[model samples]
Target: GLIGKQPSAEMERKYSNETQVTPQTPPAFIFTCQDDRAVHPDNSIRYYQALMRNGVPSQLHIYPKGGHGYGKRFTFPYTEQLQYLLTDFLNEQLSK
Candidate 1:
């Protein structure tokens, strides 16, 4: 619910618009859902794309299911796997 429960259209637009622009230093990894309809998955995808295009060293994990919300309740079967993936990603980044 922490993802898109907020009912402020202005805030939503602001958040979406904010990520469209790439920052000087992007994080090494970004995990998001591809079918996130409420918050617009393109935001993460675009950011990831921008990072890749600029060679910022990052990765994106897009689940085929699950919309907004559903942070870590394991609503989907692969949620635990995602956690492992995140851990591995962080470890890899730290090792670098």
Candidate 2:
């Protein structure tokens, strides 16, 4: 495991992005697949929730398939959609 087999409380606290989320945090674009085995979709969901709670601008996209680490892979079902969404987010941010 990336965090070691048994991560202690201090390690968890130190590595937790959600816990560090605050109103001042920058906007985010988050996406994940429901079938991702390496990282649970709930992690994205929870982080998005935290961003929303803090009134931070954010976008979240959860596809049904595509597993994990599918970035820019032509075979991934939602590759085009992901690219479009990411581009749109970046454009919107830049225009702000």
Candidate 3:
């Protein structure tokens, strides 16, 4: 719907990050919640798949419950797990 509302082709192209993904794209840490209402988890899954197809290093974590925008929120059920995953990803990246 938003794509149809774009004023011009340039505006659409400017936000189409997926089409721009390539081997040169930086490594990614993709995290999403399956039940998020704000943004669909499939977007993350597709991005991770794209990164992998291009041979880029990436990690994808899809938790079952947390809705959306739960970053650093202690009350989120997966807060500790998210922290561990993110920290481990950063450490692994830094070692490279």
Each model's lDDT: 0.69, 0.89, 0.83
Q: Which stretches of candidate 3 lie over 4 Å from their true place?
A: 1-14
Residue 34 of candidate 1: its Cα lDDT?
Answer: 69
Query: What's model 2's lDDT at 94?
Result: 91
Give the Å shift of residue 15 in candidate 3.
2.8
- lDDT score, candidate 3: 0.83
- lDDT string, candidate 3, 1-96, tens digits: 345654687865665556678999999998889998877788788788889899999999999988888885767898778789989999999999
Per lDDT, the best of the predicted structures is 2
In candidate 1 the C-alpha lDDT for residue 90 amounts to: 80
lDDT of 2: 0.89
Which residue ranges in model 2 land beyond 4 Å of their true spot? none
- In model 1, which runs have C-alpha deviations exceeding 4 angstroms? 1-24
